[model samples]
Target: MDESLRAFLEALDYDGEPFGMFYTDQEPPSGFAPKPGPALSMELEQSGAINWQEVWGSFSCVIGSIWLARKKNTAAYFEAARYGCMGGSFYLGFHQPQLDFITHYVSTGIPGTQVHGERYLRSPETVRRFFTEIAPRPAPKRFCVFKPLSQFAPGETPETVTFFGRAEVLSGLVFLASFVTDDFEAVMSPFGAGCSYLTSWPLHYLGQGRLKAVLGGFDPSERKFLKTDEMTFTVPYEMYGRFLERWPDSYLRTDTWQGVRKKIARSRDAWGEQAGQGDGKD
Candidate 1:
Protein backbone atom coordinates (compact mmCIF):
# COMPACT_ATOMS: atom_id res chain seq x y z
CA MET A 1 0.00 0.00 0.00
CA ASP A 2 2.20 2.81 -1.20
CA GLU A 3 0.94 6.03 0.40
CA SER A 4 1.73 8.03 -2.74
CA LEU A 5 -0.52 5.70 -4.74
CA ARG A 6 -3.29 5.99 -2.17
CA ALA A 7 -2.90 9.75 -2.23
CA PHE A 8 -2.85 9.73 -6.03
CA LEU A 9 -6.13 7.80 -6.17
CA GLU A 10 -7.83 10.13 -3.74
CA ALA A 11 -6.46 13.09 -5.63
CA LEU A 12 -7.78 11.63 -8.88
CA ASP A 13 -11.22 11.53 -7.20
CA TYR A 14 -11.52 7.75 -7.22
CA ASP A 15 -14.02 8.25 -4.43
CA GLY A 16 -16.94 6.28 -5.76
CA GLU A 17 -16.27 2.85 -4.25
CA PRO A 18 -14.29 4.41 -1.46
CA PHE A 19 -11.96 1.46 -1.24
CA GLY A 20 -10.69 1.26 2.32
CA MET A 21 -7.26 0.02 3.44
CA PHE A 22 -5.00 0.14 6.51
CA TYR A 23 -1.28 0.81 5.97
CA THR A 24 1.83 1.62 8.00
CA ASP A 25 5.17 2.83 6.66
CA GLN A 26 6.76 0.61 9.27
CA GLU A 27 6.41 -3.14 9.58
CA PRO A 28 4.73 -4.77 12.59
CA PRO A 29 6.42 -5.35 15.93
CA SER A 30 6.94 -8.92 14.80
CA GLY A 31 9.83 -9.96 12.58
CA PHE A 32 8.97 -9.35 8.99
CA ALA A 33 11.22 -7.47 6.56
CA PRO A 34 8.09 -5.78 5.19
CA LYS A 35 8.05 -5.48 1.39
CA PRO A 36 11.22 -4.43 -0.49
CA GLY A 37 11.20 -0.61 -0.19
CA PRO A 38 12.81 2.27 1.65
CA ALA A 39 11.53 4.14 4.71
CA LEU A 40 8.28 6.08 4.15
CA SER A 41 9.71 9.38 5.34
CA MET A 42 12.35 8.93 2.66
CA GLU A 43 9.83 7.57 0.13
CA LEU A 44 8.54 10.90 -1.09
CA GLU A 45 9.18 14.57 -0.45
CA GLN A 46 5.46 14.95 0.43
CA SER A 47 5.18 18.23 -1.46
CA GLY A 48 1.54 18.15 -0.28
CA ALA A 49 0.64 19.74 -3.62
CA ILE A 50 2.13 17.02 -5.83
CA ASN A 51 -0.46 15.05 -7.84
CA TRP A 52 0.02 11.64 -9.51
CA GLN A 53 -1.89 8.45 -10.33
CA GLU A 54 -0.96 4.78 -10.25
CA VAL A 55 -2.44 3.58 -13.57
CA TRP A 56 -1.10 0.04 -13.71
CA GLY A 57 -3.67 -2.36 -15.22
CA SER A 58 -6.77 -0.25 -14.90
CA PHE A 59 -7.75 -1.49 -18.37
CA SER A 60 -10.77 -3.08 -16.74
CA CYS A 61 -11.98 -4.58 -20.00
CA VAL A 62 -9.04 -7.00 -20.26
CA ILE A 63 -8.50 -7.41 -16.54
CA GLY A 64 -11.75 -8.53 -14.85
CA SER A 65 -12.43 -10.62 -17.94
CA ILE A 66 -9.42 -12.88 -17.35
CA TRP A 67 -11.04 -14.23 -14.24
CA LEU A 68 -13.64 -15.76 -16.55
CA ALA A 69 -11.23 -18.44 -17.83
CA ARG A 70 -12.45 -20.77 -15.11
CA LYS A 71 -15.92 -20.43 -16.67
CA LYS A 72 -14.49 -21.46 -20.06
CA ASN A 73 -14.63 -17.76 -20.89
CA THR A 74 -11.40 -17.58 -22.82
CA ALA A 75 -13.03 -15.03 -25.13
CA ALA A 76 -13.40 -12.61 -22.27
CA TYR A 77 -9.82 -13.35 -21.33
CA PHE A 78 -8.51 -12.73 -24.85
CA GLU A 79 -10.56 -9.58 -25.26
CA ALA A 80 -9.33 -8.23 -21.95
CA ALA A 81 -5.78 -9.24 -22.73
CA ARG A 82 -5.98 -7.55 -26.12
CA TYR A 83 -7.20 -4.28 -24.70
CA GLY A 84 -4.67 -4.34 -21.89
CA CYS A 85 -1.83 -5.22 -24.24
CA MET A 86 -2.69 -2.40 -26.62
CA GLY A 87 -3.48 -0.04 -23.82
CA GLY A 88 -2.23 -0.32 -20.23
CA SER A 89 1.03 -2.13 -20.86
CA PHE A 90 3.06 0.20 -23.08
CA TYR A 91 4.03 3.90 -23.15
CA LEU A 92 5.63 4.62 -26.48
CA GLY A 93 5.65 7.61 -28.92
CA PHE A 94 5.06 10.20 -26.21
CA HIS A 95 6.96 13.47 -25.59
CA GLN A 96 6.43 13.84 -21.89
CA PRO A 97 9.44 13.77 -19.57
CA GLN A 98 10.22 10.49 -17.88
CA LEU A 99 7.51 9.49 -15.34
CA ASP A 100 7.43 7.61 -12.10
CA PHE A 101 7.20 3.82 -11.68
CA ILE A 102 7.51 1.34 -8.81
CA THR A 103 5.87 -1.87 -7.67
CA HIS A 104 2.77 -1.04 -5.64
CA TYR A 105 -0.52 -2.57 -4.45
CA VAL A 106 -4.09 -1.58 -5.19
CA SER A 107 -7.29 -3.03 -3.69
CA THR A 108 -8.84 -3.54 -7.11
CA GLY A 109 -11.88 -5.75 -7.83
CA ILE A 110 -11.21 -9.40 -8.68
CA PRO A 111 -13.19 -11.04 -11.52
CA GLY A 112 -12.29 -14.56 -10.32
CA THR A 113 -10.30 -17.12 -12.37
CA GLN A 114 -6.75 -18.08 -13.25
CA VAL A 115 -6.40 -16.44 -16.66
CA HIS A 116 -5.28 -13.33 -14.86
CA GLY A 117 -1.95 -15.16 -15.15
CA GLU A 118 -2.36 -15.50 -18.91
CA ARG A 119 -3.34 -11.87 -19.25
CA TYR A 120 -0.16 -10.95 -17.44
CA LEU A 121 1.92 -13.02 -19.83
CA ARG A 122 0.37 -11.99 -23.15
CA SER A 123 0.17 -8.20 -22.74
CA PRO A 124 2.44 -6.48 -25.32
CA GLU A 125 0.34 -6.38 -28.53
CA THR A 126 -2.54 -4.53 -26.93
CA VAL A 127 -0.12 -2.36 -24.99
CA ARG A 128 1.26 -0.95 -28.23
CA ARG A 129 -2.13 -0.53 -29.89
CA PHE A 130 -2.95 2.55 -27.85
CA PHE A 131 0.05 4.40 -29.16
CA THR A 132 -0.87 3.23 -32.65
CA GLU A 133 -4.59 3.93 -32.47
CA ILE A 134 -6.52 6.15 -30.06
CA ALA A 135 -5.85 9.78 -30.68
CA PRO A 136 -6.12 13.38 -30.97
CA ARG A 137 -3.02 11.84 -29.49
CA PRO A 138 -4.02 13.15 -26.12
CA ALA A 139 -1.44 14.88 -23.98
CA PRO A 140 0.24 12.77 -21.34
CA LYS A 141 -1.08 13.48 -17.86
CA ARG A 142 1.07 15.11 -15.24
CA PHE A 143 2.25 13.33 -12.10
CA CYS A 144 4.23 10.10 -12.03
CA VAL A 145 3.08 7.46 -9.52
CA PHE A 146 4.95 4.32 -8.43
CA LYS A 147 4.62 1.86 -5.48
CA PRO A 148 5.69 -0.91 -2.99
CA LEU A 149 4.01 0.16 0.24
CA SER A 150 5.17 -0.57 3.79
CA GLN A 151 3.37 0.25 7.05
CA PHE A 152 3.86 3.78 8.49
CA ALA A 153 2.52 7.31 7.88
CA PRO A 154 0.06 9.80 9.43
CA GLY A 155 -3.58 8.62 9.11
CA GLU A 156 -2.15 5.24 8.01
CA THR A 157 -2.93 1.99 9.87
CA PRO A 158 -2.29 -1.74 9.66
CA GLU A 159 -4.10 -4.06 7.25
CA THR A 160 -3.22 -6.81 4.81
CA VAL A 161 -2.14 -5.40 1.45
CA THR A 162 -3.92 -7.00 -1.49
CA PHE A 163 -1.92 -6.83 -4.75
CA PHE A 164 -4.50 -5.61 -7.22
CA GLY A 165 -2.49 -5.27 -10.44
CA ARG A 166 -1.04 -8.45 -11.96
CA ALA A 167 2.70 -9.15 -12.12
CA GLU A 168 5.13 -8.97 -15.09
CA VAL A 169 2.68 -6.58 -16.74
CA LEU A 170 5.34 -3.92 -16.70
CA SER A 171 7.52 -5.68 -19.24
CA GLY A 172 6.97 -2.55 -21.26
CA LEU A 173 9.06 -0.66 -18.79
CA VAL A 174 11.69 -3.38 -19.10
CA PHE A 175 11.68 -3.10 -22.90
CA LEU A 176 11.92 0.67 -22.86
CA ALA A 177 14.84 0.51 -20.48
CA SER A 178 16.65 -1.64 -23.00
CA PHE A 179 16.79 1.30 -25.40
CA VAL A 180 18.79 3.41 -22.98
CA THR A 181 21.18 0.82 -21.51
CA ASP A 182 21.81 -2.87 -20.97
CA ASP A 183 20.60 -2.92 -17.44
CA PHE A 184 17.57 -4.93 -18.53
CA GLU A 185 18.80 -7.82 -16.46
CA ALA A 186 18.17 -5.64 -13.44
CA VAL A 187 14.65 -7.06 -13.47
CA MET A 188 14.90 -10.53 -15.03
CA SER A 189 14.12 -13.74 -13.16
CA PRO A 190 17.14 -15.87 -12.25
CA PHE A 191 15.56 -19.14 -13.42
CA GLY A 192 14.58 -17.57 -16.77
CA ALA A 193 10.91 -18.39 -16.07
CA GLY A 194 9.77 -15.19 -17.80
CA CYS A 195 12.67 -14.66 -20.24
CA SER A 196 11.05 -16.39 -23.22
CA TYR A 197 7.70 -14.77 -22.68
CA LEU A 198 9.73 -11.64 -21.98
CA THR A 199 11.55 -11.73 -25.29
CA SER A 200 9.08 -13.62 -27.50
CA TRP A 201 8.50 -10.64 -29.79
CA PRO A 202 9.72 -7.20 -30.93
CA LEU A 203 8.17 -5.61 -27.88
CA HIS A 204 11.37 -6.57 -26.04
CA TYR A 205 13.79 -7.26 -28.89
CA LEU A 206 15.57 -3.89 -28.65
CA GLY A 207 18.56 -5.34 -30.54
CA GLN A 208 20.96 -4.70 -27.63
CA GLY A 209 20.86 -4.11 -23.87
CA ARG A 210 19.80 -6.09 -20.80
CA LEU A 211 18.98 -5.76 -17.09
CA LYS A 212 19.81 -7.85 -14.05
CA ALA A 213 16.73 -8.88 -12.14
CA VAL A 214 17.17 -8.86 -8.40
CA LEU A 215 14.24 -11.25 -8.71
CA GLY A 216 13.41 -13.72 -5.95
CA GLY A 217 10.33 -15.55 -4.70
CA PHE A 218 8.61 -16.39 -1.41
CA ASP A 219 7.41 -19.66 0.15
CA PRO A 220 3.72 -20.69 0.04
CA SER A 221 3.39 -20.68 3.83
CA GLU A 222 4.80 -17.19 3.94
CA ARG A 223 1.94 -16.17 1.68
CA LYS A 224 -0.68 -14.44 3.85
CA PHE A 225 -3.92 -15.43 2.11
CA LEU A 226 -4.60 -16.70 -1.38
CA LYS A 227 -7.79 -18.16 -2.95
CA THR A 228 -8.17 -20.67 -5.81
CA ASP A 229 -7.53 -17.96 -8.41
CA GLU A 230 -4.68 -16.75 -6.29
CA MET A 231 -0.91 -17.27 -6.39
CA THR A 232 1.69 -16.53 -3.72
CA PHE A 233 4.37 -15.30 -6.25
CA THR A 234 6.92 -17.44 -4.47
CA VAL A 235 10.56 -18.36 -5.21
CA PRO A 236 12.97 -20.95 -3.82
CA TYR A 237 13.91 -18.36 -1.13
CA GLU A 238 17.60 -19.14 -1.57
CA MET A 239 17.94 -16.49 -4.32
CA TYR A 240 16.62 -13.60 -2.22
CA GLY A 241 18.51 -15.00 0.74
CA ARG A 242 21.67 -14.16 -1.20
CA PHE A 243 20.35 -10.67 -1.92
CA LEU A 244 19.84 -9.98 1.78
CA GLU A 245 23.13 -11.57 2.63
CA ARG A 246 24.96 -9.29 0.21
CA TRP A 247 22.92 -6.08 0.32
CA PRO A 248 21.13 -6.04 3.68
CA ASP A 249 19.76 -2.55 3.06
CA SER A 250 17.19 -2.83 0.22
CA TYR A 251 13.89 -3.39 2.06
CA LEU A 252 11.51 -1.53 -0.26
CA ARG A 253 12.60 2.06 -0.62
CA THR A 254 9.63 4.09 0.56
CA ASP A 255 11.86 7.13 0.43
CA THR A 256 12.73 6.56 -3.20
CA TRP A 257 9.22 6.84 -4.67
CA GLN A 258 9.44 10.55 -5.41
CA GLY A 259 12.80 10.21 -7.11
CA VAL A 260 11.57 7.19 -9.04
CA ARG A 261 8.54 9.19 -10.10
CA LYS A 262 10.68 11.96 -11.48
CA LYS A 263 12.79 9.47 -13.41
CA ILE A 264 9.82 7.81 -15.12
CA ALA A 265 8.33 11.20 -15.82
CA ARG A 266 11.58 12.00 -17.61
CA SER A 267 11.58 8.72 -19.52
CA ARG A 268 8.07 9.59 -20.67
CA ASP A 269 9.76 12.01 -23.04
CA ALA A 270 10.85 9.07 -25.15
CA TRP A 271 7.83 6.80 -24.71
CA GLY A 272 4.62 8.75 -24.01
CA GLU A 273 5.56 12.31 -24.73
CA GLN A 274 2.74 14.64 -25.79
CA ALA A 275 4.42 17.14 -28.11
CA GLY A 276 2.65 20.34 -27.12
CA GLN A 277 1.71 19.82 -23.50
CA GLY A 278 4.17 21.18 -20.99
CA ASP A 279 5.23 18.98 -18.07
CA GLY A 280 4.29 21.78 -15.68
CA LYS A 281 0.97 22.43 -17.35
CA ASP A 282 -2.33 21.37 -15.89
Candidate 2:
Protein backbone atom coordinates (compact mmCIF):
# COMPACT_ATOMS: atom_id res chain seq x y z
CA MET A 1 0.00 0.00 0.00
CA ASP A 2 1.16 3.53 -0.68
CA GLU A 3 2.14 5.62 2.30
CA SER A 4 -0.98 7.78 2.08
CA LEU A 5 -3.45 4.89 1.89
CA ARG A 6 -1.58 3.01 4.62
CA ALA A 7 -1.65 6.08 6.80
CA PHE A 8 -5.38 6.57 6.25
CA LEU A 9 -6.24 2.96 7.07
CA GLU A 10 -4.01 2.93 10.12
CA ALA A 11 -5.78 5.96 11.53
CA LEU A 12 -9.15 4.12 11.50
CA ASP A 13 -10.09 2.55 14.87
CA TYR A 14 -11.20 -0.89 13.73
CA ASP A 15 -11.72 -3.52 16.45
CA GLY A 16 -13.47 -6.29 14.55
CA GLU A 17 -11.95 -9.74 13.97
CA PRO A 18 -9.44 -9.48 11.17
CA PHE A 19 -11.01 -10.75 7.93
CA GLY A 20 -13.89 -12.21 9.96
CA MET A 21 -17.15 -12.55 8.04
CA PHE A 22 -20.59 -12.00 9.56
CA TYR A 23 -23.66 -13.46 7.92
CA THR A 24 -27.29 -12.82 8.71
CA ASP A 25 -28.08 -16.35 7.56
CA GLN A 26 -26.17 -19.62 7.69
CA GLU A 27 -23.18 -20.47 9.92
CA PRO A 28 -20.13 -18.27 9.92
CA PRO A 29 -17.28 -19.19 7.58
CA SER A 30 -15.26 -22.28 8.61
CA GLY A 31 -13.24 -21.80 11.84
CA PHE A 32 -15.51 -18.96 12.96
CA ALA A 33 -18.52 -19.67 15.16
CA PRO A 34 -21.43 -17.28 15.26
CA LYS A 35 -21.46 -14.99 18.26
CA PRO A 36 -24.26 -16.18 20.51
CA GLY A 37 -26.50 -13.15 20.89
CA PRO A 38 -29.70 -11.73 19.53
CA ALA A 39 -29.26 -10.32 16.03
CA LEU A 40 -29.09 -6.55 16.09
CA SER A 41 -31.60 -4.49 14.13
CA MET A 42 -28.87 -3.64 11.65
CA GLU A 43 -28.10 -7.31 11.05
CA LEU A 44 -31.77 -8.07 10.43
CA GLU A 45 -32.39 -5.06 8.22
CA GLN A 46 -33.34 -6.21 4.72
CA SER A 47 -33.39 -2.77 3.12
CA GLY A 48 -30.07 -3.36 1.37
CA ALA A 49 -30.84 -6.90 0.21
CA ILE A 50 -32.06 -5.83 -3.20
CA ASN A 51 -29.13 -3.51 -3.78
CA TRP A 52 -26.45 -5.75 -2.31
CA GLN A 53 -24.93 -6.22 -5.73
CA GLU A 54 -24.69 -2.48 -6.23
CA VAL A 55 -23.06 -2.07 -2.86
CA TRP A 56 -20.47 -4.67 -3.75
CA GLY A 57 -19.89 -2.99 -7.07
CA SER A 58 -19.26 0.35 -5.33
CA PHE A 59 -16.89 -1.30 -2.89
CA SER A 60 -14.99 -2.96 -5.68
CA CYS A 61 -14.69 0.28 -7.56
CA VAL A 62 -13.21 2.03 -4.53
CA ILE A 63 -10.72 -0.74 -3.83
CA GLY A 64 -9.87 -1.15 -7.49
CA SER A 65 -9.27 2.58 -7.80
CA ILE A 66 -6.85 2.48 -4.92
CA TRP A 67 -5.02 -0.50 -6.37
CA LEU A 68 -4.82 1.15 -9.76
CA ALA A 69 -3.58 4.34 -8.19
CA ARG A 70 -0.82 2.47 -6.40
CA LYS A 71 0.16 0.61 -9.56
CA LYS A 72 0.11 3.67 -11.78
CA ASN A 73 1.48 6.08 -9.17
CA THR A 74 -1.45 8.38 -9.81
CA ALA A 75 -2.16 9.51 -6.28
CA ALA A 76 -3.86 12.74 -7.26
CA TYR A 77 -6.55 11.08 -9.37
CA PHE A 78 -7.00 8.41 -6.72
CA GLU A 79 -7.53 11.01 -4.02
CA ALA A 80 -10.14 12.73 -6.16
CA ALA A 81 -11.93 9.47 -6.84
CA ARG A 82 -11.79 8.64 -3.13
CA TYR A 83 -13.46 11.95 -2.39
CA GLY A 84 -16.05 11.17 -5.07
CA CYS A 85 -16.71 7.82 -3.40
CA MET A 86 -17.37 9.59 -0.11
CA GLY A 87 -20.09 11.65 -1.77
CA GLY A 88 -21.44 8.64 -3.68
CA SER A 89 -21.65 6.56 -0.51
CA PHE A 90 -23.60 9.30 1.25
CA TYR A 91 -26.00 9.58 -1.68
CA LEU A 92 -26.59 5.83 -1.71
CA GLY A 93 -27.14 5.63 2.04
CA PHE A 94 -29.54 8.58 1.94
CA HIS A 95 -31.66 7.13 -0.87
CA GLN A 96 -31.48 3.43 0.02
CA PRO A 97 -34.59 3.49 2.23
CA GLN A 98 -36.73 5.07 -0.47
CA LEU A 99 -35.44 2.56 -2.99
CA ASP A 100 -36.14 -0.31 -0.63
CA PHE A 101 -39.70 0.97 -0.12
CA ILE A 102 -40.27 1.24 -3.84
CA THR A 103 -38.89 -2.20 -4.54
CA HIS A 104 -40.71 -4.02 -1.76
CA TYR A 105 -44.05 -2.19 -1.74
CA VAL A 106 -44.43 -0.11 -4.87
CA SER A 107 -43.30 -2.80 -7.26
CA THR A 108 -45.85 -5.15 -5.77
CA GLY A 109 -48.78 -2.75 -6.29
CA ILE A 110 -50.82 -2.53 -9.47
CA PRO A 111 -50.20 1.12 -10.34
CA GLY A 112 -46.52 0.90 -9.51
CA THR A 113 -46.06 -2.43 -11.27
CA GLN A 114 -47.77 -1.11 -14.36
CA VAL A 115 -45.55 1.99 -14.43
CA HIS A 116 -42.40 -0.04 -13.78
CA GLY A 117 -43.47 -2.70 -16.26
CA GLU A 118 -44.02 -0.10 -18.94
CA ARG A 119 -40.60 1.32 -18.24
CA TYR A 120 -39.03 -2.13 -18.43
CA LEU A 121 -40.91 -2.89 -21.63
CA ARG A 122 -39.35 0.03 -23.48
CA SER A 123 -37.02 -0.77 -26.40
CA PRO A 124 -33.29 -0.74 -25.72
CA GLU A 125 -32.84 2.18 -28.11
CA THR A 126 -35.54 4.20 -26.39
CA VAL A 127 -34.07 3.49 -22.94
CA ARG A 128 -30.64 4.48 -24.13
CA ARG A 129 -31.97 7.72 -25.60
CA PHE A 130 -33.90 8.55 -22.44
CA PHE A 131 -30.80 8.27 -20.24
CA THR A 132 -28.61 10.06 -22.75
CA GLU A 133 -30.98 12.99 -22.82
CA ILE A 134 -31.16 13.28 -19.07
CA ALA A 135 -27.53 12.70 -18.13
CA PRO A 136 -25.90 15.83 -16.69
CA ARG A 137 -23.14 17.52 -18.62
CA PRO A 138 -19.75 18.37 -17.11
CA ALA A 139 -20.00 21.08 -14.48
CA PRO A 140 -18.94 24.48 -15.70
CA LYS A 141 -16.72 26.99 -13.92
CA ARG A 142 -19.20 29.21 -12.10
CA PHE A 143 -20.46 30.28 -8.66
CA CYS A 144 -22.17 33.27 -7.12
CA VAL A 145 -21.99 35.66 -4.14
CA PHE A 146 -24.94 36.65 -1.99
CA LYS A 147 -25.93 38.79 1.02
CA PRO A 148 -29.18 39.42 2.80
CA LEU A 149 -31.93 41.15 0.85
CA SER A 150 -31.88 43.56 3.76
CA GLN A 151 -28.19 44.27 3.16
CA PHE A 152 -29.20 46.41 0.26
CA ALA A 153 -31.42 49.47 0.63
CA PRO A 154 -34.67 49.60 -1.28
CA GLY A 155 -34.20 50.11 -5.05
CA GLU A 156 -30.48 49.21 -4.86
CA THR A 157 -29.28 46.18 -6.78
CA PRO A 158 -27.26 43.58 -4.86
CA GLU A 159 -23.63 43.47 -5.84
CA THR A 160 -22.22 40.28 -7.34
CA VAL A 161 -18.88 38.93 -6.04
CA THR A 162 -16.71 36.19 -7.56
CA PHE A 163 -13.42 34.37 -6.75
CA PHE A 164 -11.16 31.87 -8.52
CA GLY A 165 -9.73 28.82 -6.75
CA ARG A 166 -8.15 25.48 -7.66
CA ALA A 167 -9.81 23.52 -10.46
CA GLU A 168 -10.62 20.51 -8.28
CA VAL A 169 -12.24 22.61 -5.55
CA LEU A 170 -14.16 24.69 -8.09
CA SER A 171 -15.46 21.59 -9.86
CA GLY A 172 -16.40 19.96 -6.57
CA LEU A 173 -18.33 23.04 -5.49
CA VAL A 174 -20.15 23.30 -8.82
CA PHE A 175 -21.13 19.63 -8.76
CA LEU A 176 -22.33 19.84 -5.15
CA ALA A 177 -24.22 23.06 -5.79
CA SER A 178 -26.15 21.46 -8.64
CA PHE A 179 -26.69 18.21 -6.75
CA VAL A 180 -27.80 19.60 -3.38
CA THR A 181 -29.36 23.02 -4.04
CA ASP A 182 -32.97 21.84 -4.46
CA ASP A 183 -33.02 19.46 -1.51
CA PHE A 184 -31.02 21.88 0.64
CA GLU A 185 -33.45 24.67 -0.05
CA ALA A 186 -36.43 22.44 0.71
CA VAL A 187 -34.98 21.44 4.08
CA MET A 188 -33.80 24.92 5.03
CA SER A 189 -37.00 26.77 4.07
CA PRO A 190 -39.18 25.37 6.89
CA PHE A 191 -36.80 27.14 9.29
CA GLY A 192 -37.34 30.49 7.50
CA ALA A 193 -34.06 30.45 5.54
CA GLY A 194 -33.49 30.35 1.79
CA CYS A 195 -30.39 29.25 -0.12
CA SER A 196 -28.37 32.35 -0.85
CA TYR A 197 -25.28 31.02 -2.61
CA LEU A 198 -25.54 29.32 -6.00
CA THR A 199 -26.73 31.64 -8.78
CA SER A 200 -25.02 34.41 -6.85
CA TRP A 201 -21.28 33.52 -6.87
CA PRO A 202 -18.54 31.25 -8.20
CA LEU A 203 -16.23 28.98 -6.10
CA HIS A 204 -12.51 28.80 -6.87
CA TYR A 205 -10.14 26.24 -5.38
CA LEU A 206 -6.96 27.63 -3.81
CA GLY A 207 -4.73 24.55 -4.18
CA GLN A 208 -2.78 23.12 -1.20
CA GLY A 209 -2.78 26.44 0.54
CA ARG A 210 -4.39 27.75 3.70
CA LEU A 211 -7.61 28.64 1.89
CA LYS A 212 -10.88 26.86 2.55
CA ALA A 213 -14.60 27.23 2.06
CA VAL A 214 -16.99 26.80 4.99
CA LEU A 215 -20.43 25.65 3.87
CA GLY A 216 -23.00 26.89 6.36
CA GLY A 217 -26.06 29.07 6.50
CA PHE A 218 -26.00 32.50 8.07
CA ASP A 219 -28.05 32.48 11.26
CA PRO A 220 -31.32 34.35 11.30
CA SER A 221 -30.86 37.88 12.53
CA GLU A 222 -33.88 40.06 13.42
CA ARG A 223 -35.72 38.62 10.38
CA LYS A 224 -35.81 35.07 11.78
CA PHE A 225 -34.44 33.63 8.53
CA LEU A 226 -31.19 31.87 7.76
CA LYS A 227 -29.33 32.29 4.47
CA THR A 228 -26.97 29.69 3.04
CA ASP A 229 -23.58 30.98 2.08
CA GLU A 230 -20.21 29.37 1.12
CA MET A 231 -17.81 31.29 3.30
CA THR A 232 -14.16 31.18 2.16
CA PHE A 233 -11.25 31.86 4.50
CA THR A 234 -7.65 30.88 5.09
CA VAL A 235 -6.92 27.55 6.80
CA PRO A 236 -4.29 24.87 6.28
CA TYR A 237 -5.12 22.25 3.68
CA GLU A 238 -4.69 19.52 6.32
CA MET A 239 -7.36 21.23 8.39
CA TYR A 240 -9.50 21.55 5.26
CA GLY A 241 -8.97 17.87 4.47
CA ARG A 242 -10.06 16.93 7.99
CA PHE A 243 -13.28 18.83 7.29
CA LEU A 244 -13.77 17.25 3.85
CA GLU A 245 -13.06 13.81 5.29
CA ARG A 246 -16.51 14.03 6.84
CA TRP A 247 -18.14 15.34 3.69
CA PRO A 248 -21.93 14.97 3.16
CA ASP A 249 -22.18 13.79 6.76
CA SER A 250 -21.08 15.12 10.15
CA TYR A 251 -18.48 17.30 8.43
CA LEU A 252 -19.02 20.54 10.35
CA ARG A 253 -19.11 20.82 14.11
CA THR A 254 -20.87 23.61 15.99
CA ASP A 255 -17.50 25.14 16.82
CA THR A 256 -16.44 25.33 13.18
CA TRP A 257 -19.85 26.69 12.27
CA GLN A 258 -19.64 29.40 14.90
CA GLY A 259 -16.03 30.14 13.96
CA VAL A 260 -16.99 30.82 10.34
CA ARG A 261 -19.84 33.02 11.48
CA LYS A 262 -17.51 35.03 13.68
CA LYS A 263 -14.93 35.37 10.89
CA ILE A 264 -17.50 36.80 8.50
CA ALA A 265 -18.93 39.02 11.18
CA ARG A 266 -15.50 40.37 12.02
CA SER A 267 -14.71 41.10 8.40
CA ARG A 268 -17.99 42.93 7.88
CA ASP A 269 -17.71 44.87 11.10
CA ALA A 270 -14.14 45.92 10.31
CA TRP A 271 -15.17 47.18 6.90
CA GLY A 272 -18.09 49.14 8.37
CA GLU A 273 -15.92 50.59 11.14
CA GLN A 274 -13.32 51.74 8.63
CA ALA A 275 -16.00 53.34 6.49
CA GLY A 276 -17.44 55.15 9.52
CA GLN A 277 -14.01 56.55 10.45
CA GLY A 278 -13.49 57.76 6.87
CA ASP A 279 -16.88 59.52 6.96
CA GLY A 280 -16.01 61.19 10.24
CA LYS A 281 -12.72 62.52 8.82
CA ASP A 282 -14.55 63.91 5.80
Q: All predictions: root-mean-square deviation over Cα?
A: 22.2, 21.5
TM-score of 2: 0.16
The C-alpha stretches of model 2 lying farther than 4 A from their native spots are 1-50, 61-64, 74-210, 213-282
Candidate 1 lDDT by residue in tens digits, 1-282: 454444433322221111112212232332211111211111242443322221223323222232222122122211111222222222211221111211111111124632222232233443233223322112123211111233234554312111221122122223322323334333433221111111111122222232222222221221222122222121112222232232223312234434444543454443444422211111
What lDDT does model 1 reach? 0.25
Q: Write the per-residue lDDT of candidate 2 for residues 199-258, one digit (tens) a residue.
A: 111112222221323332331321122112222212222332342354344312235434
Clashing residue pair totals per candidate (backbone < 3 A):
58, 12
Per TM-score, the best of the predicted structures is 1
Error at 53, model 2, angstroms: 2.8
Q: In candidate 2, where is summed lDDT lowest over 10 consecutive residues?
A: 14-23
